[model samples]
Target chain A: MKQSTKYMMSDGLAFSEKRDLKRLQKKSKEGWHLFSFLPMGYNLQKGEPKELQYSVDYRHLQDGEDQEYFELFEMAGWNHVCSEVGIHFFVAPMGTQPIYTDVESQIDKVQRLSKNVYMTAVFFVLMTVVSYFVSELTTGIVSSIFHYILLASEVFTIPCLMMVASLLYRKWVKKS
Target chain B: MKSLEQLTDSVFYIMAALVQPKHGYAVMALVEKETGGEFTIGPATLYTIIKKLLNENLIFLHDESNPRRKVYALTEKGHHILVKDIERRKTMLSLAERELRGGNAE
Candidate 1:
């Protein structure tokens, strides 16, 4: 028999991880278990209806660290679901201890994510600025090419800056 | 996590468990058991704290024969820091206890 699957659009984790996790939990109750991550969403496969709690952790595992890192979670009652980029998803029975129990370490997790987002935002901002300058200082085709580049960069820059702003606000809220 | 002059509760608990040379899971189990479930450290937090302690030279890998379940123990520095934190906690506890008891006596 063919399997049933569906795609759920994410609101961009930088903006809505908690909402995504809650949605995942709700989907699990409806027999749609998260199968894997999509570029901008989740691929869920229909399965047994089970109530579960989902948690996400961000870590850049080094060589030879995956085994130990995963084993620890498994032993602690969280079963690994799927990982994409540095984001790991896990599911356990409801009321399982959260992946982060302390504010200091939770802040560390946010900072790690913030660092990556900040870098991307800065890169796009630079690209936008450079292209703007080139487009202004040149003429004809070269200027037009830079103008297009400038437009693309600006397109990326807006969302990236918004993400960066949210991240900064998150860090500030956590610190205070 | 950055090395802080003061150990957070999670760090302090993990370090206390490492005084016996336990693996990551063991530390979690021990803390949960000892605290009667009053305190627990999640796996990611445990792993992060373990890495931070190792970086600060507060903990040392005691055994890695299994690779996947490497054991850790408190270093001399870790022991010293834990001892100091215990003293600090004791002071806090005694002050609260004395005040509470005096109020009750009244």
Candidate 2:
């Protein structure tokens, strides 16, 4: 047992509040809520781990096959992280770890990507309008057909420009 | 002295414990004992440190211990790091003393 020490951005619950899987299983025999954090770890080895490695089924988590668990993991941080999960779960806070996951930032990044597209659309609209009016004024000519043609041209060019912009944006904002 | 950042502190502490050839459990006990019940590392924390140390070859798992238990022994690089860290601390203490005494001299 140790005195109160500040845990750095990590689970402090392991002190008194947590139990190892072995202990948890033992407690389950006596009927204590066997809360688990991370998976049971095996002793690691050198040169490509052979057996006794934790497998993460990325497909199940990524795909909507495990929808309920996915939502819970999303709203909270982890899946299979037991608390008062069976019946008294109604009273306890629905979420577990309050810490932000990479997914949270990933969602934000997606929003930013959409925002980039919207901004690009607005910019192209403004640019097209400016170009049409300026070209008309510069040559002192009035052609509604040309205005329509210019707008149609933008339909193709704008998408191409947006694609180029997206590539550039991705390069600039590649997740470090 | 500058307070060592959390990451650096953990690294330093784990490296310090690996000065002798000791297994995972033994290192944990030694660190806990050294800190006088001030600290107890979680399994995950210890695992990460062990992984990093092993990857860097600053510490290697010795085969002398029970095959089940991962015993660690420090390398030449690890000794250099420990020595460098001690020297830096000494320099920092002297600088601190000078600054503290210098303030009163004026």
Candidate 3:
């Protein structure tokens, strides 16, 4: 019963969802099947190396319908691997139909994921602004150390937001 | 009731495939066959559409003795919509063919 696991960094924000899917597929072929999704990475278990087509569907599973949802995919021959919040991951043998068959549906899925990222970015930005104002009011000057920390928060979120915005623009406006 | 105009190509094909009760893979295979391999619905899209169709009463799950596969069939509303869409396509084709024939006569 020898089992081994590895902590592989996965994009939790899902901004690079397509890349992550490719990575997962490649990893699965190398005998690292994803067994769990941690906050900052994926936990993969050692398994027989096989070619698998990994797909991620950004959907908010409603209560009481989770079983049926999985069942539908299972019936379609996709094996459910794991899920993180609104993102569900599945893998199937090569040549299995993609989760999204049309451009419109693919765009819809990306839009939903982008919306979640946008809201999260907004929350982080709002928190930083509020904290900055509070610190300035209390100390009569924004503390340099805390200010840097707050700015660092923006550093990651702003770029992530930009990535999502550009992705949506490319798909919708440019029709790429 | 959802408008027929709102039904995308994938939804339309899935509904057509369900004229007879079918499981997920069967619907995919039927759609591919009907379209001459021009269209294929993936598992994710099919699953989502199935849920939407069920919610709209356009389709219902058929109870099958085999518990492994869940079968689905078109409801009356779904059949009516499919028939209407087919008629619309036929009418459009007739107009196009009439123009083509006129050009050939010229």
Candidate 4:
């Protein structure tokens, strides 16, 4: 069945096969396909029909089916909203999907960044508080819980920082 | 047959919508609602037109006190464009009218 994913706009930073291909090409004009494992099934096997219609239009397809998305935005006071839908349209020859970021995409990105940052900071501070207080109370069970929380937070800090870096690179470094 | 510069369909619709307070989506909605689907501007195009309108000072965003979506109404300059385009369209229609048997009905 043909399908379209409805990921929240905030979930944009996750790299797709399309994005990976573009990154490779940009890094080296003569980039090797190396290990092409893109998910749109863009590749061909012996005698398969040549690839077609791989490139995605980030713009709404304008078919009647999509009229509802157009309709919802019609509500008053929400006029400047750009549709948060971008697609990984595959192109033939050297099939590649360039990252196409628009305002809605950017908004999703900022929201994701802000939320992730806040969540991480909260988690870390909570652990720090627990670590300091649990030992003072001399309650073994509570103190163990605090240590575990601290360890979990230490594990989380790395991923969140990396995520923050990726978000920055996606927004600023690439745009610049 | 016409460059983007010459196409006034959107410009006219926007001006008409903005005669009263209408924002980006409202302009699109108003154009469609009023035109009965005869014309509908896509969101991308509508937002772009709004940016242009703001740049041209033909419309302004809502003040913070409004606590509502940004609505754009025409300025004197925008009104001039709307009027001119209306006349141009009317003149074109008149030419078509002259071709018919009951010519000059108006």
Highest lDDT among the candidates is held by which one? Answer: 1
The sequence of per-residue lDDT tens digits that candidate 4 reaches over residues B1-57 is: 121234357766777788787656667667778889776664444644555566777
List the candidates ranked by TM-score, beginning with the highest: 1, 3, 4, 2
Q: For candidate 3, lDDT tens digit of each residue in A52-133?
A: 9877787897775567567767766788889888877788999876777776666666767778777877877776787676
Residue lDDT tens for model 4, A18-136: 46435433323332222222322222222223322222223433344234333333342222212234332223343221122133333333444446465776677677667767756
Better model by TM-score, 1 or 2? 1
lDDT of 1 by residue, B8-99 (tens): 88998999888889999999999999999999999999988988898999999898888789999999999999999999999999989988
Give the clashing residue pairs of candidate 3, or none: none
Docking class of 3: acceptable
Place model 2 in a CAPRI quality band: incorrect
Residue B51, model 3: Cα distance from true site in angstroms: 3.9
What is candidate 3's TM-score against the reference?
0.77
TM-score of chain A of each: 0.97, 0.25, 0.81, 0.40
TM-score of 1: 0.95
True contacts kept of each: 0.81, 0.00, 0.58, 0.04
| Model 3 chain A worst lDDT window (10 residues) | A133-142
Candidate 4 lDDT: 0.49
Measured by TM-score, the strongest candidate is 1
Q: Give the Cα-based TM-score of candidate 4 against the true structure.
A: 0.39
Candidate 3 retains true contacts at a fraction of 0.58
iRMSD value for model 4: 11.4
First chain of model 1: TM-score? 0.97
What tens digits encode model 2's per-residue C-alpha lDDT throughout B23-90?
66566567768999676553324544565577777788675334435568889987787778878778
Stronger candidate by lDDT (2 vs 3):
3
